[model samples]
Target: MQTTFENPRYPFKHHSDLNQGTAVHHPVVIVGAGPTGLAMGLDLAMQGIPSVILDDNNTVSVGSRAICFAKRTLEILNRYRCVSPMLEKGVTWKKGKVFFQQDLVYEFDLLPEKKHKLPAFINLQQYYLEQYLVEFIDTQQQVDLRWLNRVTEVTPGVKGNRLKVETPEGSYVLTCDYMLVADGANSPIRKQLGLESRGQVFKDRFLIADVLMQAEFPTERWFWFDPPFHPNQSALLHRQADDVWRIDLQLGWDADPQREVLEANIRPRLEAMLGEDVDFQLEWASVYTFQCRKLDSFIHDRVIFLGDAAHQVSPFGARGANGAIQSVDNLGWKLASVLKQQGPTTLLKTYDIERQMAADENILNSTRATDFITPKNKISRVFRDATLQLAKDYEFARTLVNSGRLSTPARYLDSPLNTLDDEEAFDGGVAPGSAALDAPIIIGDKTSWLIDILGTRFTLLIAIDKTDISRVGESLPELLQSVGVDLVPIFLFSESTDLEVPKGAMCICDPWGYVAQRYQLEPGTCYLFRPDQVVAGRWREFTSDSLISAVNRALGFDMEVMP
Candidate 1:
């Protein structure tokens, strides 16, 4: 049961604040060097915003924590230029199997559609992901990743938040216009400010065993409910990089977490699952109980919370890190706009509103999945088993078979930033507030996925379909330019080279008709996407007045999209 991994440790350097004998001010500072904190810092750096990241640890995550990275997460990482290693090193899969008592009842495909730029999910160790982010950050001049630096105290004020950061050399005073609290669920900053993440902490316990070995298992998610090896319990199996397999087995509420993680007890469980003759080495072991919780508000004065510091969910749905990455994606551009004074401070309120709504959705899904996996009562167990028994034969039953509701990009349908469509007859699934979908697009002589270029800016995804692209785009460029707008950039998309758009617009050709078919494009149709790549507004007919209003509304310039 002996296995080891190469965990890189970073060396600490003395900051000038330790000897400056006075407080130093920065635009932004992030606490914790985990995936969330590192992502926040890296995100700002991508936008040319400098940030200081302080962490007490010198190394990345120790174990294969958060092995599942969702498609949305990869896209976000792609923007920061850190997803290449992850795609190269991780195991990508889109199919999943659900088993009832060792019998494969049914299997499902996450991405039934084709021509996607990224896979549905990837399984890689958290440490590997962090290492890649750190390596990429080292190349960017805007990030100051301080190892062994800890935040001993947080003082929030109206203008800025003050932090007392402790380092190996000494403690120093640091202040920032904004303090991003990504310090994790047990956040020191949260406690220092008397904030609480209120939600139910489930009583059931589970053990995670990272097994290392060469095996013939396919790269797919395999879940078992009441299997012979673990009767009356639920188990999950996932293949990770480096011949590591993650197995999660439920141990009742009364199980001894300490004794269960010991090799003596863990080995027997492993044997039961993979026959006694199979060979495997234990890479790591840990026990945990999950919670579906979030802070009352992710924004507290000048302090903002992201990742685990803002919300948490059970691992059953792979919502933890994926949701956290999405949170930062949603916050990064909005925060950058405010920091650069391109938008009002009130725009930050939308982050709290939109992210809290998303947190509720994830928590609800995670709680439901956990409940089905571990039935609370005999009645619930009977119902679950009945649904599982009928799942293979009856298609309707499959919908009720809740192995785990997989994570997807959150749709902020009710977000205040959205301008609800006035035309109800038009439909293509790319409605206002829907997460942007990716499709193969033809640009000039080259071909690329639509998502590769869409998420980073405010886009006017106007489909040509033979319409005059220039007429469709109109004076919208001048409208944005005349608003004294340098913070937000917009791009125009068309189905042909017919985009005689403004000189300011970067035109993209979608000649393959893939993007048109997906978006249900017709003549003179235009969709406005926010900086986070969420559909802010869509119209069956394009007009400069309407597009301008939508753009102003999206940038938090005006309250509504006028007719």
Candidate 2:
């Protein structure tokens, strides 16, 4: 359990490194036990994998940075069973208000429908999110968290990866099968890799103050643009759970100075917003700039980039934490498959394509939100203000601006993981990720369908209707396993629906189970999804011998078994 031992190869072994010396070997070594790193470690632990989470910070940031939670992120947290506490400690906002020049401009309510049995959005501080995750990680015996252990350098070794880390006790080396770098925008690991960050950096800086106000502010988020009080400044007042307000002021590029802008200007703006003499104890305040940048690739040999280390979105649409979680979810399963030796090595390349596209889309969303706030030129400013004002009269225009489609999960369309033909192709429709694909059908049950049927291995979903269950069950499992395959058979029970009789069909259902893949009651038809959720291979009217051959092809194995 003690991770300190002397290793001469450590790059930082001169001064502070002498105090600490440990040697550690882990399946996955993660840097920065922040929200992104903790989420990755939690997921890997759930899959029975061991992970070491190391962070240089002595403690989690007490100030609120990212507060809004998207629908996708909530769904992920639910899987780890951490959503309940998060929802309890966080403020849930169903409505938002936007204003201009001290007048009501537009207001909109979040999606009220229970689309996926989760709320639309929740606003909680980033620190609480990390704390809840740390608690959950402590409960898992397989997850190990090491605070104040800073990852100094990462070198891609011939066989695996070599990581140099420094702790209060001393310094040591951590060799791992894979390294996840999540050390934020100024990531030293990324710098060591020499990966260049590409994007535009706006000159404007905003002052953010997290304070508890005596007077009441509406729970809904309120935004102002060029108000009469401060015509040159745009302000945002976000209502937190503990009667706290996170206020952001758009200070001009050439402000007096950073501290002056905060203590002298930001405090007064908050006092004015309250509209009366009120005591506001400022907890934390600082000036931060926005940048729209992304890395060229997320994968570089044994090391993969994650969170702000991979890309940065301006804090407009609140997409940073949500996007980072998605990146981890995308990479988690692929890493598992590669380590388990069940999938091809090339599947790892798809992580870059899928996550980069998602990050690029987030950049666009943040850029658009930034433009709407501080338009580039006079012409754009006029257009943006007019649109916000017109939103009061027109419902359609307001909905367009409020959709937040950029926060949605990135689809795996062009990746080799997708095997849909013209008929089964995604017609601009959302497809479940590998984890959600072929999830068990939970009809009239409170539990998720996939929870019961999906073992910790490959499975086959069979929608059997009057088919021979005994012959299919006994022969298929043995036949598949003989050819280096692990298949679990699942049956779909639907009495009234009309289904054609196909020999082998894999039933695919929507997340809500409206309708999707269907096949007849024939016993020989088969459909397969890779561990990562992409359809690997499909077959119809095949014998036991022939089906084994198909499974082998999907696994990219040439070994022939005595079927």
Candidate 3:
């Protein structure tokens, strides 16, 4: 299939004919339109940034790869104003169940003793999630999504980057200010960039099938090890929205082929759990091995890799897409700040620092999950099964057993981006809530603190007396506006008692609230926060000169913006 282009302009300016290479220019070019790319697009679009999203596939994938959605991801989507419809369709799970030798041994509820604006987890089909995001992107005036276009070659240009993309029509060249590579596990962009990735690919394979069942399996997730149906294998089942159940079977590495496994392998296990008479239709099925790895660097010159392009993790805890979207949430605001020139381009380096920490956390959790499911050898397997069985009787053991190392925002206390003075001032320490990073704090009268404000802009939690506001009010707003910085200033009173309130701390909440800068209230003191929400500079012992300098440093301003 060959096509011709006489001449194209603007977005396709660098395009050549299918056979002849022409050049097209786009401010931002993304390689894949999976959750990460679509998310990055939404983040940029919210800031009114123009970008182009391209995917190799012509249509959305029918296979349900990632079915579990985390609380953190739902929060990021809420920022773009798309979560309403999705929450309507997603199934919320309040608890999870674990079994050993057909005995119900462990049960844990995510909402046991806490209050939160969002549920801990929701089960939604990946296809529908993608549909919602893609639709949202289509509605954005700043976005152009091109499907069925595959990149055959990417050449780093002198100033920017050049990409040769192949399509059903033909091949064209695309020059971009930055290339956000959200392409999946077998990312060609990561390979083309020559970034080294090292990890272990397990020899074992698992058969996964999504089925619609009529039987009454509780909404909670269920898993069985060494069941009568398949004595040596592991069977895990999860209930999804609309009575759909995602089932996975550990089939060792060299188990039966796909056809035989689908036709003859799964019924026995299904019968063991749902009774022999239960009926269900298979939605999708596949066999694949789990992998763990990370890229040597997320940023290589003008191209920044995201999602699976940067790292690959097992599907054990549904970390792949969820973690990737979190990475997007972390990088989006920083990129926007750099583009607007409100912050130094050097601030872009912090994207690597912060997101790389996130990647490391994901890798650790993912590896722990992978090891828990697939032990290395016979001795490891025995130890895992014995520990799980022993956990049935002891409370301490059960906590460790059911915990699964789940997922949480990585702590950024040790980063150089953090202000040393804030750490000393916080009686609670430099981390967000000081609750061992278990759950994010909720603001007073606000339905959300973690998800709603995240992935949008920088936030300033101003702790000041109402009487003294006039002093800071004169120059604070003007300084923020001059730097093109989006600032959210929240006022806290001295006598406020809300635990969720930021307290005597004047803090900065970035798109992701992993770290908040704290300052003990001084009558006139104010702090400037970077787009990443780390403190760029502080105005403690406040003076007009000192405050202006902090603002300058926060915005990376060499010279003050003249009034």
Candidate 4:
């Protein structure tokens, strides 16, 4: 066996302190240039907003951490033009298998729908994702990424928040209209503000080892409970780029974290799982205790929190980075709007509402996964073993096996911004406050995706035929345009008519009615989408007054007219 450990450290760069004597003011100052921070900066830059990003380090993530990139996250990355490089380098997998001892109990597919453009999931190292984002950020002149700069102090202010930063040159003071924090789990800014996350921390620890070896195993998520190699413990295996495999072995509470990460202790575990004859190199190893915790409110006056700085969860479901990216998607547009005065300050509160809800969901799922993987008492272990045993033979028992309910985009169904259904007869599908679903469509002579056509703006998707477009053309476009909102109408052509779409809106031929079926579209139906691609409101028929009200409501305007 040939074993070696290779962990490259990121070099730190020197940055001149901009706030030496005078406080340099910026519209947005983001702390930490990790995935969340970099994504947010790119998003803001795309929206024509300038921001400064401060980071303590100068390189991408050190290890292959947070490898699973969800579809929704991929879509967000696509908006920033960062998804293609990731897809080109990532190992794509949609199938997963669960094993009890040596026998395979069940298998699952993450993405059953094939019509969508992006797959359900892709396994790419976090470092690669961050590097891709950094490349994109470098192209945008509006984004100022200052490496080797750390925020040493934070003070709240009336107009804006002030930050005292330390760099290689010296220390300086800076002020920003808004401060977005995306530091990792142990957020220094979060602690500087005397804030605390409240949640449960599991006692069990997990040893993660990244081994580089050539193997014939398919690129799929494999999990085992009480396997012969590692008895009475849970283990997970997944493939990554460079033929490096990520193996997670559950180490009981009694195991010493320091001793477990030793190469001598880890080598035998790898040999047992991959046979003694196999040659492998130890890429990286670490031991961590599971924790599910989050802040009560993500927003604090002029300061806002994003990513691990706001919430954290166990690594079982890959929720940490995915959820952080979603937070970036949610906050980017809203913050830009508020800063540009297109939206009220109250609009920022919705970020807290929506992302807190998402954080709660992640925490709940993470806690459940931790509990299932590490049963507390004898009775729980008995129930867990019984479920695993029964799942082998019975189909229904497979649902009881919880190997980390995979991460999914959270639909804000109960959001206050949603416009409830006015047409009672319409069929239910992607409703108001739900993330927009993707489908294949024909645009001109080329094939395109619905999401690709729906640019980052307020869009009205109308399912219409030739006859219905005339009626919709009467006042819909002009009314929305008058309010400075581009009503980029996407006409989903119905099969009944060869309609010529009216000017000012793009037309897509839905030959198989995939878009119509997915949206549950009725003739003349309309959907108002926010900049983040969230369904703001949907109606059975388009009315100028109704659409205006919905758009206003989505922008956080008080819809009530004063007498």
Cα lDDT listed for each candidate: 0.84, 0.66, 0.67, 0.86
Candidate 1 clashing pairs, residues 3+ apart or interchain: none
Question: Considering every candidate listed, which one attains the maximal lDDT?
Answer: 4
Q: Residues 1-563, candidate 1: write the lDDT tens digits.
A: 56557889899998777888888999999988889999999888766699999999999988888999999989888877788899999999999999999788999999998888999999999999999988988998999989999899888999998889888888899999999989888898889999989998998999999999788999999999999999999999999988999999999999999999999999999999998999999989999997999998999999999998889899998999999999988888888888877777878888888888889999999999988998889999999999999997999999988877999999888777787785565655587777888887766667877787766567776655444655545656566675444423333355445435566665666666677778787756777877677888888776767767776677676644211
Candidate 2 structure quality by residue, lDDT tens digits, 384-466: 77777787788876754432332655565555454333344333222322334323344333334443333334556554444
Q: Residues 1-563, candidate 4: write the lDDT tens digits.
A: 23232333445554444534688888999999899999999999878899999998878787787999999999888888779999999999899999999999999999988799998889988888888788788799999898888899999765799998887778888899999999988999999999998888899999999898999999999999999999999999999987888999998999999999999999999899999999889988889999899999998888899998899899999899999988998898888878888878888888998888899999999998889999999999999999999998898899889989898988887777788785465567788878889998888877888888664677888887676677787765577567555557777785434566667777888887789888898787888898888998988877888788887788788633211
lDDT, candidate 2, equals 0.66
Please give, for residues 1-563, the per-residue lDDT of candidate 3 as tens digits: 11111111113222233455457677789889888899899988887778888887755555677888887677667777888777898888868877777687778776664535567788887877888887787689888888778888988754689888877676778899899999888888877777777887877888887777776777777777766776777788887766678888888877765653564566665666667787776666778887888887788778999988888887777778888877787677767877877677666566677677777877787777767777779997888788778878877767555224555545544444443355454454234311121224334533234334432555554546556655655656565555355666554444434333222223322222232322344444444444434444444444456544554444434422211
Q: Residue 226 lDDT in model 4? A: 92
RMSD of each: 2.3, 7.5, 7.4, 2.7
Q: Which of 1 and 3 is the better model by lDDT?
A: 1
The global Cα lDDT (0 to 1) of model 4 is 0.86
